[model samples]
Target chain A: METILAQLLNGLDKGGAYALIALGLTLVFGTLGVVNFAHGALFMLGAFCAVAFRQFITYETVTLDPTKLSPWGAPLEIKTPMAQIWFGDFGAVLINWSVPISILLAIPVMLVIGIAMERGLIKHFYKRAHMDQILVTFGLAIVLQEVVKAIFGANPISQPMPVELRGSADIGAMLGLTPGMVTYPIWRLIYFLFSASIIGAVFAFLRLTTFGMVVRAGMADRETVGILGINIDRRFTIMFGLAAVVAGLAGVMYTPLVPPNYHLGMDFLVLSFVVVVVGGMGSLPGAVAAGFLLGILQSFASMTEIKAIIPGIDQIIIYLVAVVILLVRPRGLLGRRGVMET
Target chain B: MNIFYLPRRDAITLAVFALVVLTMPIWLVPFGAAYPGLMQKFAIFAIFAVGYNVLFGLTGYLSFGHAAFLGVGSYTAVWTFKLMTMNVIPAMIFAVIVSGLFALAIGFVSLRRSGIYFSILTLAFAQMCYNLAYSVLTPITNGETALQLTINDPRVLDLMFSERGAGLPSPSLLGQGMSGIEAFYVVAVVLLIAFYIAQKIFVSPFGMMLRAIKSNQTRMHYTGFNTRPYALTAFVISGMYAGLAGSLLAATDPLAGAERMQWTASGEVVLMTILGGVGTLIGPVIGAWLIKYFENIFSGFNDAMLHHTFSWLPQGAQDVVVAITSKFVGEGWQLSLGLIFVLVVVFLPGGVMEGIRRFSSIFRNRREPGPTGALKTSPAE
Candidate 1:
């Protein structure tokens, strides 16, 4: 029972990430009608935003300490982070909480990037073949990743979580299991909650707001919406920005879990794409459902008992699921009829 | 002539192409790219790209898993070398057959969907193959270290010929060692044959059917013609082409790595096809050569080489030039490649062929008297 619960928790944690990334992907696909291969780069860029923010806050101020003298130097130098020097305790708190603080920084940054990407490159590819869109966006992805690699070098940079959130939580005792049986990381749980809240917020915004209704209507039929004298293009562009923000925020929050790296975007991109396909193209709820389903399936596959039966099945379960889904149900789980069919 | 036959001009063009390929070693020397190994790779990858074009360029199905076939070919060739003989012929044949089978299986499943879904399915299958090769199939693939010839392998043909000696024997044809410049010729010949087959298919009814499928599959379906077989055949043919290329890669270098089957490798061929001009006979070959040249030659350019190349400049100017150019070479080759991909896709959708045509037309217009009149009158005429 404890193992099942542990696996469920693990699965949900991973599913949160998948859902976040796929949600963004489906949003862009639904709104723009162009498959953005560079969406992963946006996620990577978001993680870097957090990294940059952390670096900015930790910039040091060097000063000479006359009272202390070095053995071979005139005087000892004291180095303090500019944040601490400028704001004292609050600055220390800020530095410790850079991950959450990065959410603020990533929103505006990712929005601009998303809008600029749409306006500059993807705009022209809207009318082109799917192959052209894929090629161009893939090219853009390579450029973004290479530029990131150039700046950060080709190494994973670990981001420190806050001191309060560093340890694992004992859920076993609370759940009436053995005391030490179900300890899960506190941050992962927090990430799950954060992602759920974000997903909920997005859904609520879409459900309750007039702007979202218009956007939803536009997604269903752009021509009809446009014929009704609505500037759906601008809303769609904003929708693109919102998707970027979601992906960016996901990336920002994810840094503490998996160290940020130049290739993180690409790694996540493929999996998220799989998720989107399995969920059914252009179906937002489908993306979320498939994300969780695949995530749980993956977690279950990783169990030792499962591995013993089908060796290396864990590594390929998602792809196998994708193939099976594609074969059995061509339109995907929640896909509309004839979405990409000829 | 029949509608499916090559035009007279196309026949001459093929001959010229054959001549250029045959004499590549001699002509490439002036450009410092005459090394036999690189030249061999040029031919092998050109075959791969041309085969890839048969599906992607002729038909608009953008397969993202062709590298899986290539990997299959390499593995088969290496195994043939290990178990049977160091003969290139058997290895090539085995590789092609094995890859063709694998392609048939993968294509049968993936061809069920069209467009992005098809791409995803292919990618899924390739990634599955790659993942399996990396983990469970490691015993067959030799895991991450790459599969290479070992001393204890049973070489039936080698033992029959009494050719056992110190170190591993090189793959040979008719008792002649197929390495160095000899291997280049072998690859070049095979490339010509591959190109010939591709040309024949391009001008054949099957090729027209593929083009028709690319333009509108629904119409083809409604016309009472089953489109699945045509697509499946193209997929298998292209897969065999990739397999042949992979076999040649092993036949030349004699090692096979799982990385060869990676999606990035698949993406490289796609880039080559598009960059050179998709659907054109010579475009993919040019794209392959251009990419291979950049990968091998441009990446070899270092700070020292840059400094030496710009030695005629003043000291400060030389440093500045080297600093700027160094980033786009060596470790930065991928960046430049990305930029080129973007620029090409954006401006020259027809790729290098389109650029060449536009350039030639500009020169033709300039050379003729009354250029505007000539341009207007020529189209009407």
Candidate 2:
């Protein structure tokens, strides 16, 4: 029971990430009818946002301390973090919280990127074949990752969680079970809660807001929405920005779980794409549900009990599920009729 | 195979292609690719790209898992080498049969859907194969260490024919050993045969059916033509082509690894096909050669070479020149590839073939000075 509960927690945080990335992908597909392969690059950029922010806060100034000579007889150099010099203890706090705080930087930066991508490159491809769209965006993704590689090198850069939230929490004790029985990292739990809110916020925005209704209508019938004189193009572009922001935020939160590497986007993008297909192409709710479903199934498959029966089940369960779902349920779990099938 | 009554233009094109391929070791010297290893790769991957183009260009089915078939072929060939003989003939035939079966099963399932779903399904299936080969099937695949030729126990055919040799035997054609330029010639001959077969398919009525399916599957369905079988056949054929390519890889270098089945390899074929003109006969081959050349030769260019090339410039100017050009070559070549791929897709959607066509059309128009002559004989001609 403890093991099962712990795995469920593990699944939830992973599912949160899958759900977040898939959400953005589905949104872009829904609104633009364009498959954005560069979405994973956006996620990687978000993680880099955290990395960049940390570097900014940890920027140090050095001064030679002539009074304090080292054993080697050279004057000692004192290096102080720029944040510390500017804000004292607050600067130290800023560095500690840089990962979470990077969200502020990621949003606008990712939005501009998303909008620019849509306007500059993707706009030209809208009339082209889906393969062309995929190819061009694939090229864009390579360029983006390569650019990151050039800047940060190919190695993964780890992001540090805040000092307070770094340790695992004994959730089982709080839930009235044995203490420390179902321990999970504090940040993971926070990430799950954070993603849940983001998903909710997106849902509410689309369900309740006037602008979102228009976007939804645009998704349903682009020609009809355009005929309605709403200038749905502008709103759809913003939705693309929203999708980028969502993917970025997911990356921002996920950096501590896995270090950000140049190829992180490609790896995650492929899985998220599988997640999208399993959920049904362009189906928002289906993306979320499938994300969690695959995540949990994957978690369960990785269990020693499961592994004993079927070796390497965990390595391929997600892909296997995707294949079966794609074959058995062509439109996916909640997919509407004739969406991307033709 | 029925290309015996080849069209006038196609025959000439094939003749030229054959001449170019046969004399590659000599002609490619100027490009610094004259050496046998890179030349062999050029022929091998040209076969891969050409085979890939049959299904992708003709049927418009973008299979993302074609490398799985290639991997199956490689493994089958290597297993043949382990169990039967070091002869490439049996290996090639066995590899084709196994990978064709593999493709049949996968294509049967994946062809149920079209568009993005098809791509995703193929990708998923390939990833599954990679995962299985990497872990669960490690006994057969040798996992991460990879499967290579050995001289331990069985070489049933070679043993039947002759006594055991002192060292491990290399892959051979008949009684003679194949390596270096000889191996390249063998690959080149196979590529020529594959190219001829691809051209035959392109002109065949079956090819017309596949093209019709690509253009309008719905209309074909409405006309009561079940297009799935045609698509499946193309898929299987391409799978066989990929398998052949894989066996050739094993023949050239007796090793099979799970990395061969990875989707990135599959992506590389797609890039090759697209980088050349899609749907064009020689486009994919050119694309394959260009990409392999870039990957092998261009990537070998380092800052030292760049500095030497720019030795005439002043010190500061040379440094700046080298710095700028260095990113587009060597380890940073992928950056250039990505940028170039993007530019090509955006501007020259038809690929290098289209660019070539457009460039020639300018001269043709300048000579003829009218649209009538250009229209009758395709600017492509």
Candidate 3:
């Protein structure tokens, strides 16, 4: 029971990430009707945004201190972060909370990026074949990754979590069970809640608002929505920006768990594409459900006892599920008929 | 117009192409890439790209997992070397058959879906193969360090030929050791044969069916023609081509690494095909050669080399040029490749072949008297 609970927690935490990335992917696919292979690059760019913010806020000034001489008899240089000099204790606190603070930086940055990407390159490919879209976007993805690599180098850069949430929380004890039985990371719990809220916010935006209704209508039938005299293209472009922001936020929050690297986008891109496929293309709710399902399935597959029977199943569980889901339900779990059927 | 008949113009082009390929070691020296190993890779990857074009160019099925077949071929060839003689022939044959079977299984399942779904399925299957090769099937794959020749392996035919205590023998054709230039020639000959087969397929009725499938699958289906078998056959044949390339890689290098099965490698073939011009016989080969050249020669350029090349310029100008051009070469080759890919896809949908045709047609038009004469010399011709 303890093991199951722990795995479930792990699965949910992972599922939150998968769900967030897949949601953005599905949104772009649903609205633009172009398979954005660069979606993962956006996620990666978000993580880098966090890293950049942290670096920017913590910019240091070096001064020579005569009292602290080095072994070579030269004056030792004392470096003080510029934020600390400017804001004192608040600077330290801000640095500690940089991951959360990065959301502000990421939103505008990602929106501009998403809009530029849509208007500049993907706009031309709207009438082209899906293969062409995929290839061009893939090229764009490679360029984005390489640009990141050029700036930050190829190594994974770790982003620190807030000091208060450094350790695991005893969920089992809180729930009146054994104290250490279901201890989970506080940050992970926070991430899950955050993802849930984002998902909810997106849903509410689409369901309740008139703008979102029109967007939804556009997703169903672009020509019909256009016939209704709605500038669905502009709305769709904004939705693309929204999708980028979502992916960016997911990446910003995820940096504390997995270190940001140049290749992180490509890695997640493949899995997220699988998630989108398993959930059915252009199906938002299906993407979220499939993400969690695959995450949990992958978590379960990774258990030692299970892996003992089916060696390497953990590595391939997501892809295996995708294959199975695709074979069994070609339209996916909640996919509407005729969506990407041709 | 006969399918089997070689048109006089095409025959001349083929002869010229063959001559260029055969004399690559000599001609490529001026480009600072005369090394036999590099020349062999050019031929090998050209075969791989040509094979990929059969499915992607003809049928418009963007398979993102073809590298799995390549890996299968390489592993099979290596295993053949381990168990049997160090003869390239039997190893190549075994590699093709094994990879062909693997392709058949993967293609059968993946072909059930079309468009993005088909691509995702193929990608998933390839990733599964990669994970299996990397971890679960490490015993077969020899994991991480790459599968290479072992000293204690059972070489039944090898034992029959040479004495028991000789060092690991190089892959040979009959009795002649295929090393250095000989290996390049061997690969070049096989490449020519592969190109010949691809050309035949391109002109064949089967190729037309594939093109039809690409243009409109629904129309073909409604007309009583089964498209599934045609797609599967194309997939298998291409898989065999990839397999042959893989075996040739092993035959030249005598090692098989799991990295060969990576999706990025599969993507590389796709890039090669698209960069050259899809659905055109010569485009893929040109793209393959260009890519391989960029990877090998262009990537070797560094700041020092750049500075040396541009020494006549002022120091400030040299520095500026070096700084700018440096990003497109060396470790930054992929960035340049990405930019080129985007630019090509955006501007020239038909690839470099289209660019050449357009350029030549512009000259042809200028040479002609008026609009009527220009019209007489159609662009297609």
Candidate 4:
């Protein structure tokens, strides 16, 4: 029972990431009628934003100390961080919270990237074949990945989680079941809740706002919405920006869980696409449901007993489910009847 | 006989293509790429791209997991080497069968969806194969160290024929060594044959059907035709071609690694096909050769080479020039490829073939100007 609960937590955490990425992908598809292959690049750019931010904040200035000499007979070098030197304790605190605070930095950067990508490149391919969009975006993705590799090198850079959230929590004891029965990482739980809130915010924004209403209407019937004399095109561009922000935030939050590598986006991009397809193309709720569903199933498949029964099931369960769902339920779990069906 | 029938111009084009491929070692010397190893790879990858062109260039189905077929082919060829004989003919045949079956299964399900959905499905399936090959199928694939030939109890055909040798046996044809220049000839011959088949398919009725599907699948379906079978056949045939290429890789060097099956390798073939010119006979071959050249020769340039090349400039200017030029060469060749691919997709969708056609047509038009000749690149002579 305890094992199942722990695995459920793992599932929820993984599902959170999948849902977040798929949400943005589906949003772009639904709103702009585009299949953004470079969505993964946006996720990668967001993580790099945090990496760059941390590097910027804690950049060190070295000085040779005349009073202290090193073991090698050279003068001892005193290194002080630029941020902490300028801002004192406040700067130190800022560096400590840089991972989470980088969200602020990631948002604006992702917005400009999203808008520029749409206006400059994606805008022209709107009427081209789907293959062309895929090709161009794939080329863009390779460029982004290689550029990041050139700057950051090929190795994964591990981001430090805040000291306060470093340990595990016994949720079993907190829930009054058994002490130390189920211990899960605090950041993982936080990640789950963060994703839940983001998903809620996106849904609420679409449900409540007039702009979102127009956007949703446009998704339903683009021509009719355009014929109504509204500047739906500009709104869709913003929607693309919104999707980019969501993907960026997901990448920012995910850094502590998995080290940010140049290959991270391509790795996640494939899984996220499978999730979107299984959830039924252009179905937001379906994407989320499929995300969590696939995630939990993956967690369970990795169990010892499951591995003994069907070896390597954990590695391939998500893809297997995608294939099955595509074959059996072509519209996906919560997909509409006609979206991308043709 | 009907399949062999080609128009006079296309027949001449085929003969010229064959001549050029067969003599690559001689012509490539000027570019310093005349070595047998690089020449062998040129022919092998050219075969891969030509086969790939049937499905992608003609049909427009952008499969993203094609490396899985190639990987399977390599694995099968290696296994054949272990279980049967070191001869490459049987290895190639078995590799084709296994990869063809693999493609059949993948295409049956993936072809159900078109556009990005199909691409994703293929990608997912290939990733699954890669993962399994890395883990559970380690016995077959040998995991990270790679599947290789070992001196063991197997090789049933060789055992029946002669006494066992003390050392590892290399790939050969009927006990004749098939390494170095021989391997290049074998690959070149395979490419010429594959090119001929591709040409036949390009002019066949089925090829026209594939083009129709590329232009408008919905209209084709609405016209009471089942296009899935045709697409699946193309997919399987191309998969076999990839297998042949993979087996050739193993035949040259008897080792198969899981990394060869990665999506990145599959993407490379797509880059080759698109860069050369989709749906053009000689385009994919040119694309493959160009990319292979770029990957091998362009990336070989180092800081010292760059510095030496720019020595005519002043010391400070030479360093600056080397720094800038180094990015487009060496490790950043992929960036150059990406930039070129993006430009092609945006401005020149027809790729290098289109560029050549445009260049030649301009010369042709200056001599004989007419409205009817705009679309055709007739011989200047």
Q: Using DockQ, give the best candidate's number.
A: 3
lDDT of 3 by residue, B29-141 (tens): 88988998899999999999999999988888889999999999999999998999889999999999999999999999999888888899999999999989999999999
Return the clash pairs for model 4, or none: none
User: Judged by DockQ cut-offs, is candidate 1 incorrect, acceptable, medium or high?
Assistant: acceptable
List the global CA lDDT of all models: 0.89, 0.89, 0.89, 0.88
Worst 10-residue lDDT window, candidate 2 chain A:
A333-342
Residue A266, model 1: lDDT of: 84
Residue A92 error for model 1, in Å?
3.3
Q: Write the per-residue lDDT of candidate 1 for residues B7-73, one digit (tens) a residue.
A: 7877877899999999998999888899998999899999999999998887788898899999999
Q: Candidate 4: fnat, from 0 to 1?
A: 0.65
**In terms of TM-score, how similar is model 3 to the real structure?**
0.95
In candidate 2, the second chain superimposes onto the true chain B with a TM-score of 0.94
- The Cα error of candidate 4 at residue B357, in Å, is 1.9
Error of 1 at A96 (Å): 2.5
Give residue B64's lDDT in candidate 4 (0 to 100).
Answer: 96
Please provide TM-scores, in order, for all candidate models, with all chains considered together.
0.93, 0.95, 0.95, 0.95
Model 4 stretches astray by more than 4 angstroms: A69-74, B1-3, B314-317, B366-381
Question: Which of candidates 2 and 3 reaches a greater TM-score?
Answer: 3
lDDT of 2 by residue, B1-381 (tens): 453777878889999999999999989999889999899999999999999999888878888899999999999999999899999999999999999999999999999988778888899999999999999899999999999987784989889979988898999998677799999999999999999999889888999998888777888888999999999999999999999999999999999999999988888898888899788889999999999999997789999999999999999999999998987788778888889889988888778887887789897776543222110111000
Candidate 4 lDDT tens digits, B1-381: 664688788799989988898888889999999998899889989989999989987777889999999999999999999999999999999999999999999999998887777888899999999999999999999999999999994999988888899999999987778789988998899988899888889888999998877767878888999999999999999999999999999999899999999988999999998899887888889999999999999889999999989999999999899988787888888888888888887877888888887789787776543222111211010
Give DockQ: model 3: 0.53
lDDT of 2 at A287: 95
